[model samples]
Target: MREVFQQELREVQDRLVEIAELVAISIDKATRAFNESDVSLAEEVIAEDPRIDQATVALDELAITILARQQPVARDLRIVVSALRISASLERMGDLSTHISQLARYRFPDKVVPKSLRSTFAEMGALDVEIANKLTSLLRSEDVQLAEEIRNEDDKVDALHLSVFDKVLGEKWKGEAVDTVDATLASRYHERFADHAVAIAKMVQYLATGDWDQSAA
Candidate 1:
């Protein structure tokens, strides 16, 4: 029974890595679509988002089953509980990517942001993609160092997010109402995407080190 329980735990980890990989791909494609105004790619992301949702649902069910059957305690209990929270965060990340792609689709033919803020949005998108990739690695390897790196990248995304607001609200701003709205919404989605990645990284770090404060970095 103990061996079977351990196998279930490994399956939970594998499922998480699989979902993380899907999230990475989603963000990569979503960011590309947002940057280049590729409506087809945007639509592709929107369509595939259901798959990510289904995966998370399945993972949650699995975690619940393990909890009920094995009645895990101590570290085993933490692993199961963390898996549930991590899967929820991953699901939200996928939704944020879809939101980014939706913005691209909404403004098809024209870029989402005006020329003035294009570079800023582009940088935020790139950082989000990088963070998603790093999050996948962190989950698969349980490397606490990767968690710290994710936190640093998330800080960059947060800074970029604030800068977007500052530019839109500045007196020099010239964009129309639609542009302002899109820029704000897009920046928010990008920032929140990184936030979810950081949350997952912290959970992974906690699993590895068993110290929430140490993982809080």
Candidate 2:
């Protein structure tokens, strides 16, 4: 029975890592769609979001089953609880990717980001994908240092988000109202995606150290 319970725990971890990978792909494709103004690619990203969501839901149910059947105690209990939280964070990250893709799709033919801000959005997208990949590593390895690194990457995303605002609101800004709205929403989605990655890393850190830090999330 003990071995079986342990196997279930391992399965949960594996599923979480799988979910992270899907989110990474979603963001990567979404970024490409946005950059190229490729409506088809954006549609693909949007269409696949349901897979991430369904996987997260299934993982949550499995975790809940383990909690009930195994009645996990101490560290085991922590693992189950944290798995649930991490799954939720991963799902939210996937949703953010979908949101970014939606912006690209909505603009169709024309670019969602104005030419002046394309480079900035491109950089933000790259950072988002980098942070997501790091998140997958952190989940699999549970390395606290990697968690810290993910947080640092999130800080870069935050800085980029602020820069977008500065550019849009600057006196030299010439974009139409739709352009301003699209840039703001797209930057926000990328920033929030990083935020979810950081949150998952914090959950992993708490699982490893048994020290929960709300501020980090």
Error of 2 at 10 (Å): 0.3
C-alpha lDDT of residue 184 in model 2: 90
lDDT string, candidate 2, 1-217, tens digits? 8999999999999999999999999999999999999999999999999999999999999999999899999899988988988888889998899999999888999999888899999999999999989988988899899999988988988999999999999998999999999999999999999988888888899888978898755
What's model 2's lDDT at 146? 92
The TM-score values for the models, in the order shown, are 0.97, 0.97
- In Å, residue 210's CA in model 1 sits off its true spot by 1.1
lDDT of 1 by residue, 134-175 (tens): 998998899889999999999999999999999999999999
Q: What are the lDDT scores of the predictions, listed in order?
A: 0.93, 0.92
Query: In candidate 1, residue 94 scores what lDDT?
Result: 96
Model 2, TM vs. native: 0.97
* lDDT at residue 120 of model 2 (Cα atoms): 92
